[model samples]
Target: MESIKLHQFVPISGEQKPARVPRRKVNGPATAALLIKMATEILTASPTLRHQTNITLTDLAAAEKVRKALLKTPLQ
Candidate 1:
């Protein structure tokens, strides 16, 4: 009969917390698509929140720039 051996957790020396693994990078178009989907969900869930915030035109313009950049559109 073969016996199974379970691995035990070993804490790293001199470190109180474990190191964080780096996140995998998402490609450009996929990232933009995800952002658009998230925005749609948020807006649909809480339409009134948009009217209550202190988001200025400049902020909006900056966000538009980011959105355009994410969508790979040429800046005007």
Candidate 2:
């Protein structure tokens, strides 16, 4: 199985620490679809982050592409 490097920031006692978070390896089509779904949900739930950039429409369109691609893939 392959792995991706995903860093998460953790705050402890007023200090911000960058930690290397372990993410499940997307070894197959099913895992890819799952990752896409999770990413889309995170983007949708964080409205403030989405609105931070002026190109919210573009961002949303990109996210939509992810969803579409996930739908097209046949999960096993």
Candidate 3:
């Protein structure tokens, strides 16, 4: 008679992977103010003058006006 051998497998435990950290939003008050200025310019511009790539003088002036106003006011 021949003897039989059985093999067993076991899982190895190791150090856990480094935890993932969430990234912080870099866009702050300055970006918000710019966005507000751009939105105001677009909203105030005439429909026919609204262009995707190019900004007309009127639109630029309007946006600049809003941006200046925003800068004059204190951020809350």
RMSD of each: 9.0, 18.5, 10.9
The per-residue C-alpha lDDT of model 3 at residue 57 equals: 66
Better of 1 and 2 by TM-score: 2
Estimate the overall C-alpha local distance difference test score of candidate 1: 0.63
Could you say which candidate leads in lDDT?
2
TM-scores of the candidates are 0.35, 0.37, 0.34
**Which one wins by lDDT: 1 or 2?**
2
Number of clashing pairs per prediction, in order: 0, 0, 0
Q: Compose the digit string of candidate 1's lDDT tens values, residues 6-76.
A: 99998677858777999986576657756865665565456476567754445555665666666775323
Per-candidate local distance difference test: 0.63, 0.68, 0.67
Alpha-carbon runs more than 4 Å astray in model 2: 1-27, 52-58, 74-76
Model 3 pairs in collision: none
Model 1, stretches more than 4 Å misplaced? Answer: 1-26, 53-76
